[model samples]
Target: MNSTRMRITTIAKKELVEFVRDWRTIVAILVIPVLMFPLLFILFPLLLEAEAQELDELIVDVELQADDLPDGFQSALEYSSINLTFAELDAVENLTEPGTAMEKLRSGEVDAVVRVRANNSTWQYAVLHMSTSEQSNEARSRVLLNLGEWEQNETRNRLVAVDLDPDATLNPLQWNGSIAQGDVASKGEQAGLALSLFIPLVLAVWTFSSAIQPSIDMTAGERERGTLEALLGLPCTRAELLFGKWLAVATITAAGVLLQIAGLTFAIGYLATSDIISAPTMTLGVVALLCVAVLLFAITVVAFELALAMRAHSVKEAGSVLGPAVLLILFPALFTQVINLDGIELFWFAIPVVNVLLALRELLLNRVVPVHVLVWMVSSAVYATLAALYAARQFNREDIVTTLS
Candidate 1:
């Protein structure tokens, strides 16, 4: 390596050693990455599934009010975890009257109320429940499910009553489902779609986290400790010193990201071809895109962090400035998750974090266009360069002795 590269390396090595010495930092940088993916993708989903099953198995009390019931329809109301209580005539009349049932539902007099009355020649059914109540919602679901079964059974009975075969006469529609991929291509893209859903957010968030300590500690921490002043008195120019420290912070942040990606890879491997990833994907192209995106994203974030950190006199102050910065990554990631990519305008690539997110999603989805990749790289590089220049300029001021130049 040249003298400049060698100097940067020396500084980076020192920073990494000091950072790794702290057990808590080690856990944040190393352990959390390995553990986070499994917990987020696996344990969380399992808990939600358990909650759903619990809801399905719960016994909810419901009051049934029926005036003219269809033949054998009441017998079909048995698919859910509901405790049925036949309502008295006065109670039935009060429930069907209108505003009174909602009050009874809110007051917990019943989990849900079901009403069936004659609509001229046919039966009309209604399920009333408090939308805010978990129990009431469950009861409502059960009632709807029972109604669905009864409707089907009643239709079949109607055909049988006409001396026709219920199976042949009652059902005429035929349907089946499969994916519509126009031609045979790598299923890898579909797999990337699932992974891409979380990876962009992961890159933005963890990249911020990984940069925080090293960036703040190198600048504010050193200044507060009086080491920065003495170090500035060395033979190197302000640019060299600034570059060296930036290199160190970037290195540590990248290392942490790699560890986190390794953990994410392990979790993905464990879940490959499972329900979580029905179309597992891996290719050299996918790997290439991921690395490019990660590096570009890291460059922009590290420079931003270093610039802010250099201006702060204390690590706490630097932290406070950069803490809410994570939300900059978070909300966009969430918003982009729900947006239809088909209508995404070309101008979106000009926005910073949002650009990275869109690029990652598109790249991972194998919708790569050469122009889009070029735009992402060019914009990111320009942004990174500007931020790095600003950070380096901080050293030109009397920053070694004071917070401002």
Candidate 2:
């Protein structure tokens, strides 16, 4: 037992050294995860916020005739943040056109056109026309909000004239919402719900991307370099050799994922400092669940990728096989993001990549059940072990070992 342990350790150390020496592997593992996290979590939101601010500051040019304007209408427009610049309706250059107001709007000379027309009775109608541009949408929303407020106030005044309480008629039902009075979600918990859908997909892709290159380089690259046969001839058994290579891959993948988690935490921290997003409450239990999921996922991916790599005749062929495999794993997680998680069946927990993603999502949302975690952990372990055994068996095959052309 001791000798076998020593043999595996020796092989693992050698694989680790070889992996570390390859600067390409080092850069892929370190740089990509670090860069991707900030780009997704930190920079993307900041850019969106900046664009939204710019949109908020837009000056909307509106066209309306002074004679058609209602009393106190301009005062109502003054209450909104959107800058509403009013111009005469006939100022439109195309005066002969039947749709002159629409012509000015379509020509981009005005953001929107507001017209109020009254029939023979007291009822009047207002029409707002604008294109579907971002500035136009902002102007429309602000105008609609002010119009809605005006409508409500007018209704309330008419109700008072009829000797009726506006509140009783307008809001017949009223209810206050609270988090069970005492049970409230922490900022971290709230952040988790917001991130629950996205984080799984990101981590899934990160795990697969981090594991594939090293796994291929270790298995198929060695075969291409004519060194795999030499290593197989060593005194260590095939299981030791396979385990060592898989361990090295898993180690590297887990390291990259850990760094990625740290990077994401830092990015979220930076965003939280702006008070735009709540800080995730990363409890020790949550961290443990995440760590375990990452470790299991890495092992499963490395073993499966190593198995695929072992079948390939060259590194290029291995990449061709594994690149699509990464997407295959990634798409399921993304699919989960779109679908309702509550609707997912228990059988999904038995599906390899899908299980871990769901489990992690549940953990992030602080709604994880112990049985689900157990099921996921057990299923993943079984799959990983089976994949590792298959890789070890492949290493022992005479055809695979002797196929060094």
Candidate 3:
């Protein structure tokens, strides 16, 4: 037992020294993700807000018969600061036809067109059009306000004509909607899902990239350089070597995951506090779940990467083999987002990366995951352990190592 511990400690120290000495590798592991999340989550929303403010200005084209417009209608349009441009009713004879008006609106020549019917009644119709898809919302708001004023005037005229009281009760109805299932997830849940969907992908990338290069270089790269044989002849047992290498990979991957989490937490907190997003506060419980999930995810990825690395002749070859595994880790997490399985099912918990993402999402939303979530976590850990053991067995084989060298 002491010998095994000493061997593992020796290998772990060597791995740490190699990792720290490579400045480029260290930067790749730490800097990129730390910078990306803040830029994506924080600055992107600010840009959108600026664009929305710019979109609020709209121009309206009015073509009303001189007598058809009510007394206060034009004044109302002016009061709303709708940039009203007028064209003679005949000047737009066929040019201002419905289709032409629509084309003009789509082309940005006008924000909206108001056409007063030849009948001098107060029942004239207005159609507002916007060039840009985003500008349509602002156009709709202005159109609705103008339409409401017109409706009110028409209602008063009818009341006066019928000699009826304005306050007489019309169709009286009351309606309400309620859900009795467990406390319905608020908009906060949706926001949480949105914030967390990329977390799994981020973790996968960090784990694979941070561990893959070093893991391959530690094993396959040493083999290519003829240094692995010397180390193998040392009195180190296979389990000790594997444990030490695994520990090193886990350390780097875990550090990467921690850095990613730090970046993500800062970005998310900024967004929530700034009112850009309506996510709930991440409690200690949720943070604990996230930490566990990230740890397991890192171990699984590092194990898989080392297994592939052990099979390759060189670091480049190992990278090629492990590239797909990196993409595969993203799948289970991505699948969680695309699949909306019922929360009560135990089957989903048995799945690997998917289970972790689902559990974390539930935690963030303050949902109590079933006890089976722990069972699934244990199962995933078993799977990762078995993979590491299998890789260690491969490392113990003389023929496989010789062929790679």
Candidate 4:
């Protein structure tokens, strides 16, 4: 037991030295996420806000047949922040007949053109035209509200025309229900799920990248440098060496994942406070779930990477073999978006990366996950352990090691 501990400690120290001495590896593990968070969370929102602030003043052309329409109809447009310009019949004829107004609106000289026909009664129809779909949609919304007022006025006119009293209809059935207020924690949880959808994907990328370099260096790089042969010739048993190296890789990978979590948490919190994003505060429970998820992901990545590294002739070859694994992590994230959690099957919980993501998302959203989630998490951990053992067996094979050399 003492011998194993000493071997692991030595390997861990050696790995740490290699990691710290390499500036590129150190920066990848630390600096990239720290920089990415603020840019993604803070700068992006500010840019969007700036763009939204520049509102184009809409030019509206309204023609009413009646000398006076109800003030409510005009007020509706005013309330919607529309700038209305009333046009005389002569102006409408010149604009529409010559198609000058339509051309102006299309040329960006005018925001929108609203045409009211000469036969405008309370049952009048208005036509709006805009160059862009977005502007047209907004103009349509404002015009619809004005049209509603026109309908109301038409109804009132018909009531007066028919000599029917407006107050004759009595309401017998009433709806009197109060809305239940939710606490901040509940609201925060709702917001957290929306924010946390990408966390699993981010975690997976961090795990893959963090594990890749170390796994390649420990296996293919060691063999290329003739260190593996020297180490194999030592008094230490192959099992002890494999265990030590695996432990070392797992620790490094886990540390990198932890750094990513910390950076992401801080970035998200900062951005939320700044109103850059609408993420919830990171609670202890949320952090715990994230930590566990990351731990499991790290174990899986380390085992997978080590196995690939053992098969490759060089670090470059190992990278080529492992690149596809990083892309595979995106599948869980994409699946989370496409697959509704409410429709999740119990069997899905047995899948490794997918389960962790689903469980963490549920935790973030304050949803009560089933006990099977925990059961699956335990199963994933066990599976990772078995994978590590399999990789170790591969490491002990004489033919494989010799082939790599």
Q: lDDT per residue, candidate 3, 1-405, as tens digits?
A: 587888898898899888989889888886766876788888887898888667654453443323356557667666444666665443344323565566666776665666654444434454545635555546656766876886777677778788876555232443345543445766577677666666655665667677887788878887888878888888888778878888888887787777777788788778878766776556677667667766776677777777788888877788788777766666676777666645457777777767766766666655666575576678778878877777887677775458444
| TM-scores of all predicted structures | 0.85, 0.82, 0.73, 0.71
Residue-pair clashes per prediction, in order, are 0, 2, 0, 0
**Model 2, TM vs. native:** 0.82
- List per-prediction Cα lDDT, in the order shown: 0.77, 0.78, 0.70, 0.67
Best of the candidates, TM-score: 1
Model 3 regions more than 4 Å off = 57-82, 88-210, 223-230, 275-290, 338-343, 367-370, 397-405
Check candidate 3 and list the clashing pairs: none
Q: What is the C-alpha RMSD of each candidate to the true structure, in Å?
A: 3.4, 4.2, 5.2, 5.7
Q: Is candidate 1 or 4 superior in lDDT?
A: 1
**What lDDT would candidate 2 get against the real structure?**
0.78
* Candidate 3 accuracy as TM-score: 0.73
Worst 10 residues of 2 by lDDT: 89-98
Question: Model 4: per-residue lDDT, tens digit, 1-405?
Answer: 587788867877787788778899778776776666667766877887775554334434332323344545555556435666665433444333424455655665545555544344432344546636556555666567677776666676677788975445322454456443534455466567666677666767777777888888888888777788878888887777766777778887777766666677777778667654555656687567666766776777788788888878877888898877777777776786566778678877777677766766766665656475576678778878887887887787785457444
- Model 2 CA RMSD to the hidden true structure, in angstroms: 4.2
- For candidate 3, the 10 contiguous residues with the lowest summed lDDT are 58-67
